[model samples]
Target: MRLLGFGLTGLVVLLALISLVLGPAAIGPAESLYALFTDTGTPLTLVMREIRLPRMVLALGIGASLGLSGAAMQGYLRNPLADPGLIGVSASAALGAVLAIQTGIAAHFAFGLPLCALAGAVVGVSLVMLLAGPRGSSLTLILAGIAISSLAAAFTSLVLNLSPNPFAANEIVFWMMGSLSDRSMSHVWLALPLMVVGWALLGSLGRSLDALTLGEDAAEAMGIGLRRVRWQVVLGTAAAVGAATAVAGAIGFVGLVVPHILRPLVGARPGALLWASALGGAAMLLASDVAVRVVLPSGDLKLGVVTALVGAPLFLHLIYRTRREMA
Candidate 1:
C-alpha cells in the first residue's frame, strides 16, 4: 500500500509537470520548469506563473477533492456508487454559481460566486443528510440524493430560463459544461483553502472508515462514532466538491472513477484508499487536461466532456460488474 501511494504521488507530480509544459504556446520542458521557479518577467515566465501554474494547481486540487470525497463517501455509505454528484452537491453548487452569474454579483465581487456555491453545497449536503437520516440505508441515501439532484437541476434550469440576457444564459450554459482554460491564480486561491479544509476533515476519518468496513454495529462496538463520521463526510465533501465546482464548473467522475480504479491497489481498504485516490485523481485530471490541449488546441473541447467520454464507459462496466456480483 505504501508503494502504491508513492507510485501515485510520483505519477501526479509527473502529470503536473507535463501540464505546465503543454499549452497553446510552445515551451520546452526545461524552460517551462525554469520559468515556473524563477520568474524573469518574460512572456514564458508570465504564462508559466500566471496561467498554466494556476490551472495545474486547480486540476490537482479539484481532482484530489473529488477523489478524496468520493472515497470517504463510499466508505461511509458502504456503497460503490456513492459520490458527491450522487448527493446533488455538485448540482447545487452549480446552481449557486449560476445565480451569482445571473445576478452579476460574481462580476462585482470576486469571491461572490464561489462563496455562494459553497453555501449551496452546504445546504445541499445538509438536506441530503436530513432526508436520508444519519443512519439511513444505502437505498434511502440514493433516493434522497436523487431527489436533491433533480431539484437542484430544475432550479438551475429555471434560473437560466428566466434570464433576460442571452449572453448571460449562454455564458452560464458554457460554464456548466466545465473547463480549465484561461483560469487565473485567483481561482486557485479561492478554492484551495476550502478544499484543504475538506481534505483534512475527510482524512481524519481513516480509522473510522476502516472500522466501518466491519459493519456499523461492529464499528460502534469498536468505539467508532457513526454520527460524527456522517457529519464529517457530508460537510467535508460539500466544502471540497463545492469549492471545486465553483472554480471548475461541475467536472464529474473524477470522484466516481478514481477510487474504484485505485481501490484494488490499496487492497480494498477504504481508509487506505484516501491518499492513493487523491493522487490518482490528480494524475487523471492532469492527463485529461493535457489530452484536451492536444486533442483540441483550438479550445473547442471542454474538460467535462472529455471526462464523461471516459467515465461513462467505466461507469457502465462498473454496473455490469455489480450485476454479475449480485448474480
Candidate 2:
C-alpha cells in the first residue's frame, strides 16, 4: 500500500510539473522552472506565477477533492455506481452558474458566476440534508439527492431556454462543459478553504469506512457511528464538489472514474482507496489539462469534455466487469 501510495503521489507531482510547462507559450521547461521561483519581472514570470500556477493548483486541489469525495460516497453507500453528483451538489452549482450568466452577472463581474454557483451548491446540499433528515437511511439519502438534483437540472435547463442572449447562452454552454482557462489565484483562494475542510472531513472517514465494509450492523458493533459517517460524507462531498464545480464549471467523472480505477489496486479497501484515488485523479486532470493545450493550442477545448470522453469508456468497462462478477 505504501509503494502504491508513493507511486500515485509521484505521478501526480510529475504531471503537475508537466502541466506548468506545457502551455502554448514557447517557454522551455528550464526557463519555466526558473521563472516560477524568481521575480524576474519578465512576461515568462508573469505567465508562470499568474496563469500556469493557479491553473495547476486548482486542477490539483479540485481533482483531489473530487476523487476523495467519490471514494467516500461509494464507501458510505457500498455501491460502486455512486459518485459525488449523487447528492445534487454539482447540478445545483451548475444552476447557480447558469443563473449568473443569464442575468448578466457573469458579464458584469468576474467572480459572480463562481460565487453564485457556490451559493447554489450550499442550498442544494442543505435541501438534501433537510429532506433526508438527521437519521435517514442511505436509501432516503439517495432519494433526496435525486429529487434535489432533478430540480436543479430542471432549473438550469429553464434558465438556458429563457435566455434572450445567444452570446450568453453560448458562454453558459461552454462554461458548463468546463475548463481551467482564464482562472487566477483569486479563484484558487475562493475554492481552497472549502476544499481543505472537505478533505479533512472525508479523509478522517478512513477508519469508519474500513469498518463499514463489514456491513452497517457490524460496523456499528465496531463502534462506528453510521450517522456521523453519513454527515461527513454528505457535508464533505458538498464542500469539496461544490467548491470545485463553482470554480471550474461542471467538470465531471474525476469523482466517478478515479475511485473506480483505484478500487482493485487498494485491495478493494475503501480507506486506502480514498487517498489513492486522490492522487490518481490529480494526475488524470493534470494530464488532461496538458493534453488540451498540446493538442488544440489554437482552438479551445474544454477540460470536462475530455474527461467525459475518456471516462465514458472506462465506465462502460466497469459496468461490464460488475455484470460478469454478478453472474
Candidate 3:
C-alpha cells in the first residue's frame, strides 16, 4: 500500500509537470518551468501563469475530489458498482450551467455560468436531503437522488429545446460535454474553498468506511455512527462534485473508474483506497488533459470525451464481470 501510494503520488506530480509544459504553444519544457516561476511579463509567462497553471491545478483538485468521493461512496454502500453521480449533484450542476447559457446570463457575465451552476448544485443536494428526510435509509437516499437527477435532466433538455439562439444552444451542448479550456484564476478561487471542505469531510471518513465494510450492525457495534457517516458522504460528495461541475461541466467516469482501478491495489480496504484513488484520479485526469492537447491541438476535443472514450470500455467490462459473478 505504501509503495502504491508513493507511485501514484509521483505519477500525479510527473503528469502535472507534463501538463504545464505541453500545450499549443511551442515553448520548451525548461523555458516553461522558468517562465512559470519568473513571470517576466512575457507572453510565455502569461500562458504559464494565466492559462496552464490554473488548468493543471483545477485538474488535480477536481480529479482528487472525484476520486475520493467515488471511493467514499463505494465504501459506504459496499457496492463496487456505485459511482459519485449516484447522488445527482453533477446532473443538477449541469442543469444550472445549461440554464445560464440558454438565458443569456453566461454571455453577459464572466462568472454567471459557474455561479448559477453552483446554485443548481446546492438546490439539487438540498432537495435530495429533504426528500430522503432525516431518518432515511441508504436505499431511500438512492431513490431520492435518482428522482432529483431525472427531474433535473428533463428540465435541462427542455431548456435546450426551447432556446431561441442557436449559438447559445450550441454553447450549452459543448459545455455539457465538459472542458477546462478558457478557465481563469478566478474560477480556481471560486471552486477551491468548497473542494477543500469536501476533501476534509471525505478524508476524515477513512476509518468509518473501514468499519462499514464489516456491515452496518458490526459498524454500529464498533461505535461508528452510520447516520453521521452517511451525511458526510452526501455533503462531501456534493461540495466537491458540485464545485467541479460548476467550473468544468460534467466530466464523467473519474469517480466511477479511479476507485475501482485502485481498490484491489489497496487490499480492497476502502480506507486505504480513498487517498490512493485520489492520487490515481489526479494522474488520470492530467494525462487526459495532455491527450486533449496532443491529440487535437487545433480541433476541439473535450476532456470529458477523452475520459468517456477510455472509461466506457472498462465500464462495460466491469458490468460483464459483475453479471458473470452473479450468475
Candidate 4:
C-alpha cells in the first residue's frame, strides 16, 4: 500500500509537469521548467506562470477534491455508487454559481460567487439528509440525491433561459460546460484554501470509515459517532466540491471514477483509499487537461465534456456489475 501511494504521488507530479510543457505556445520542456521558476517576463514565462500554471493547479486541486470527497462519501454511506455529482452537491454548487452570474453578484463581488455556491452545497446536502431521514438506507439516500440533482439542474436551466443578454447567456453556458483554459492565479487562490480545509476534515475520518466498513451497528458499538461522521462528510464535500465548481464550473466523474479504480488496489479499504484517490484524481485530470490541449490545439473542448464521455460509460458498467452481484 505504501508503495502504491508513492507511485501515485510520483505519477501525479509527472503528469503535472507534462501539463506544464504542453500548450499551443510551443514552449519546450526545459524552457517550461525554467520559466516556472524564474519569471523572465517573456511570453513563455507569462504563459507558464499566468495561464498554464493555474490551469494545472486548478485541475490538480479540483480533481483531488472530487476524488477525496467521493471516496469519503462512498465510505461513509457504504454505497459503491456514491459520488459528489450523484449526490447532488456538484449540481447544487453549479446552481449557486449560475445564480450568482444571473444576478450579477459574481461580477460585483470578488468572493461572492464561491460563497454562494458553498451555501448552495450546504443547502443541497441538508436537503438530501432531511429527505433521506436519520437512518435511511443507501438506496434512499441515492434517490434523494437524484431528486436534488434534478431540481437544481432544472433551476439552472431556467436561470439561463431567462437571461436578457444573449452574450451573457452564452458565456454562462460555456462556463457551465467547464474548462480550465484562460484561468488565472486568482482562481487557484480562491478555491485552494477551502479545498485544503475540506481535505483535512475528510482525511480525519479515515479510521472512522474503516470502522464503518463493519456495518453501522458494529461501528457504533466501537464508539464511532455516526451522526458526526455524516456531518463531516457533508460539510467537507460541500466546501471542496463547491469551491471546485465555483472556479472550474461543474467538472464531474473524477470523484466517481478515481475511487472505484483504486479501491481494489487498496484492498477495498475505504480509509486507505482516500489519499490514493486524491493522487489518482489529480493525475487523471492533469492528463485529461493535457489531452484537451493536444486534441484541440486551436479549438474549444470543454474539460467536463471529456470527463463525461469517459465517466458515463464507466457508470453504466458499474451499474451492471452491481446488478450481477445482487443477482
Which parts of model 4 are misplaced by more than 4 Å? 107-112, 126-144, 315-327
Candidate 2: where are CA atoms >4 Å away?
323-327
lDDT of 4: 0.86
CA displacement after TM-score superposition, residue 280 of candidate 4 (Å): 0.9
Q: How far in Å is the alpha carbon of 163 misplaced in model 2?
A: 1.0
lDDT of 1 by residue, 1-327 (tens): 777867888888999988889977766799888988997778888889899999999999988998999999899889777777887799989988899999998889968877888788878878888999987765677788899999999999999999999998998888888888988999898899989999999999999999999998999999998778877887898888989998889898889988898787888999998888888888888988989899879857889888888888988887788799999
- Clashes counted in candidate 3 amount to 0
For model 2, state the Cα shift of residue 122 in Å: 0.4
Using TM-score as the measure, name the better of candidate 1 and candidate 2: 2
Q: How does candidate 1 score on lDDT?
A: 0.87
Task: Assess each prediction's global lDDT (C-alpha) against the native.
Answer: 0.87, 0.93, 0.91, 0.86
Query: What's the residue-level lDDT of 325 in candidate 4?
Result: 89
Pairs that collide in candidate 4 are none
What's the count of clashing pairs in each model shown?
0, 0, 0, 0
RMSD of each: 2.0, 1.1, 1.4, 2.5
Q: Give the per-residue lDDT digits (tens) of candidate 3, residues 1-327.
A: 778978998899999999999887777999999999997788999999999999999999999998999999999989877888889899999999999888888989989999999999999999999999877777888899999999999999998888888998899899998898888999999999999999999999999999988998899899999889989999999999999999999999999988988887888999999999889888888989899999989999999999999988988887787799899
Better of 3 and 4 by TM-score: 3
